[model samples]
Target: MAKLRTTFVCSNCGYSSPKWSGQCPGCREWNTMNEEVEEKTKVSAVSSVKSKTVFSSVSSVTEISTGDELRYNTGIGELDRVLGGGLVKGSVVLLSGDPGIGKSTLLMQACGTFSRDKTVLYVSGEESAKQLKLRAERLNVNSDKLFVMTETDVESICEYIKVNKPEVVMIDSIQTMNNAEIQSSPGSVTQVRECTNLLLRTGKSLDIPVIIVGHVNKDGAIAGPKVMEHIVDAVLYFEGERNYAYRILRAVKNRYGSTNEIGVFEMGDGGLSEVENPSQALLSERNVNVSGNCISCVMEGSRPILAEVQSLVCTSGYGNSRRMSTGFDFNRLSLILAVLEKRFGYRFSGMDTYLNIVGGLKLDEPAADLPVALALVSGFTDKPVPDDVVAIGEIGLSGEVRSVSRISARISEAARLGFTKCIVPRSCLKQIKTKADIEVIGVRNLHETIANVF
Candidate 1:
C-alpha cells in the first residue's frame, strides 16, 4: 500500500478540509463536515484498449479540452434550444425544477427522441418501469430503444451501463441514487456527489451523454452540494410558476454553445409542448385599450417577445409615496419615476405608483422603459392608449429613447402578434422598413415618444 488519507468535506458546498470544524466556511452550515476514506493503490484495469481517446479532447496526460466536435440531438426543439442546440458527449447535465413541473416529462421526452433512433437506458431511482410506462402511454410516446430500469444502487446502474453500452443514459433523479462506498443516506450531499462522480467517469469512458435530474431546494435552487453543479458540463434550470401554464427552461452553463438561449414550453394534458412563438401566448386576449396597460416588445437571446405593462398612480395620503412593481425591475421603475419628477416635474412623490407587466411576464430589458412610463402616465391621467399600438426603445435618465438590440426582430415579432403600429428608436429606422399595412413611428428622444404616445 502506498498510503491512506482521510479528510472532512462539507456536505453543503463540497468544501474539503483537513479536519472538521464547528461551522463550514463554504456554505455556513453547522456540523455538516463528514469524514471520508481515500486509499492510494496501484492502477488495475479490467478492460483496456488505449490510455487516451480522441473524443475526450485531452491534449496531454493531465489536462483536457472540452470543445470537442460532439453535439448529440435530444430530439426536442425547445430542449435543444435551451441546451445550446444539442447535448455535448461526455458531459454531465443537471436538470432541476419544481415538483410536478414536468422535469421528468422533459427528460422522458428526451429519451423518447433517442429511443427510436438510438439506444438509451433510463435508470429510474424513484419511479418503476411500470410507472414510467404509464406516463409514457399517457404522453402517447413511442420508443423502441428507450429502456427503463428501476434501481437506486449506483453499483448496479454502473454495471448495467458497462454491459449494455448505452449511447445515452438518464438518471431520473440523482438524489435517489446512492453509492455503497458512502454510508450517508440517499440524496445526502455525500451520496449525490459520489454518484455524480461515478456517472461522470462512466460518461467520459463510454463516450455517452449522461443527464441527471435533481429536485430543487426550498430556495428554488439545486438541492445537494453546490459542487454538484460545478462538476457537470452543463446546468439547466427548469423554471416557471406551476400555477401558470408556461415553463421556461434556462441554461446556466454550456461547454458546447452559448448559454444565453432559453426554451419556452407549455404544460398540457399530454405532455410538455414546445412553444414555437411564446410571445403570442404571453399577451392577453382581452384587449388592453384602456389606461394602465401598454405594449412593449423585447428580445430574449434572439427571440423577440411582446409584453404588456400596467401601472397605477394616485395621490399619496402619507408623507412619502409608495412605488410597487411586479414582473419588472424595481430600479428601472424608480428611474422612470425620477425622470417624471425631475425632467417632466410630475411631482410623483406625492403619489402611490404601482407598476406591473401583464401575463405574469418579467420584463428586464431597458426597451420596456418607454412603455412602462407611458403606462404610468396612462394610469395617472386615466387615458387609454391605442390598443393596436406597441413600443420598443430604451429610456435614458434624461428622457431619451435609446435604441435597443435586435430592433428588427422585435418589430417582426410585434407585427406577428397583429400589432398595427410600432414605436421604435429612430436609430433603428434605417435598417428595417415597416410592413405595408402596419405603421412604424420613429422617435429619437423621450420627449418625442411622450409627445407621440399622448
Candidate 2:
C-alpha cells in the first residue's frame, strides 16, 4: 500500500510548503495556506516494449497559414468585438465574475447562437439539467444541437468530449470540477489547476473552442489558484453592479484578441441583450443644465464611449471630511481634490465630496480627469456647466491640462452625440487633421478651462 503525503499550498499563488503557516510566503497573504493530501503510487516494473518517437517540422512565421474559417461567430456582435473577431479554434476562454453578475447567462446565450450550425456541449458541475433547462427556456435558448450534461467528474467529461467531438464545449464552472484521481477537494488549488489543464489539452487536441466559467472570491478576484488563469488562452471578466442593469465584459488576457476591448450588455427578463451604442445607452438619462454633472469621452480599445461624471460637495458635519467615489478610483479622487485645493484654491477641506460615473462604468483613463475636475468645481460653486459642452483632457498636479492620445476620436464621438463645444488639451490641437462639425476649444491650464466652462 502506498502512503499518503500532506502538503500546505497557498490558495492565492499556488506556492507549496511542507508545513502550514499563517501567512503565505509566496504571495504574503494571510490565512491563505491550506493543507492538501496527496496519495503516492507505488512504482511498478517497466515494460520491455519500445516506444515510438514522432517528429514534426517547424514552420516559419510566413509559412504558417491562418484562414478566416478558423473563427466562429458567437452571434453576439459585442461579444465578437471583444473576442477580436470571433472565437478561434482550439482556444480556451475563462470567464469569471461575481455572483449574479450574468456570467452563466452570457455563455448560455452564446450557446444558442453556436448551436445554429454547430454542435455544443455544456457540462455543468453546479446546476442540474432541470435548472439549466429552466434557464434556457427563460432565455429562449432552445436548439436541438445544444446538449447539457450534469457531472462533476472532469476525467469522464473529457473522455466524453474526445469521443463525441462537439464543435464547441462549455464548462459551467471550473471550480466545481473534481478528478477522482486527485486526493484534494474539488475547489482546492491542485484540483482546479489540474482540471483546467485537462480541459485545455482536450480543446487543443480536438481543435475545439472551450469556454469555462469561473467563480470570484470575496475580493472579487477569480477563485482558486492564479495558475489556472495562466493555463487558459484567454481570461475575461464580467463586471457590473447587482443593483444596476448594465454589465461590462472585459478581457484581461487574450492570445488572439486585444485585452483592451470591452463588451457591454444589459440584463433584462429575456436575458442579456447587447448594447449596440453603449455611449447612447449610458447617457440616455442625462439631465441637462444640472450642476455637478459633466460629460467625458473614453476609449475602450479602438471604440470611443462618452460617459458622465457627477460630483457632490457639501459641508461636512463630522470631524473628518468624508470623500467617497463610485465607479471612479478613490485614490484618484483624493489626488484630484488635492490638486483642486492646492492649485485652484477651491476649498474641499471642510466639505464632504462624492463622485460617480454614470452607468456603472469605471473611468480608468486619465482623459477623464478634466471632466471630473469640472464636475467637482460645478458642484462646489453650485453652477451648472453648459449642456452642449464636453471636456476631454488629462489634468496635471501643476494645474495644466495635458495632451491625450486619440483626441480626434474622442472629440468626434462627442460631436456625433450632438455636443456643440469640446474642450481639449492645447498640445493636441495639431493632432486633429480633419475639421469636425463641433467647436473645439483648446486650453493649456485648469484656469483656462474654468474661465471657458464656468
Writing each residue's lDDT as its tens digit, candidate 2 over 1-454 gives 7688899877778888999998889989888788888665722111111122122334677987775588999999989988889999999999888878998899999999999999999999889999999999999999999999999999899999999999999998888999887888888887888788888878987899999998876441224526578888888889998888999999999999899999999999999999989999999999999899999998998989999999999999999999999988898899989999998899999999999999999999999999999999999999999999899989888989999999988888988889999999999999997477999999999999999998
C-alpha lDDT score of every prediction, in listed order:
0.80, 0.88
User: Clashes in model 2: which pairs?
Assistant: none
TM-score of each: 0.83, 0.93
| Candidate 1 Cα misplacement greater than 4 A, ranges | 1-69, 219-226, 314-322, 433-437
Best model per TM-score: 2
- For model 2, how many clashes? 0
What value does the lDDT take at residue 400 in candidate 2? 95
Report the error of model 1 at residue 194, Å. Answer: 2.5
**lDDT by residue for model 1 over 207-285, one digit each (tens)?**
8889999887543123353658887888888888778888888888877667878888888988899988777788856
Judge candidate 1 at residue 226 and give its lDDT.
62
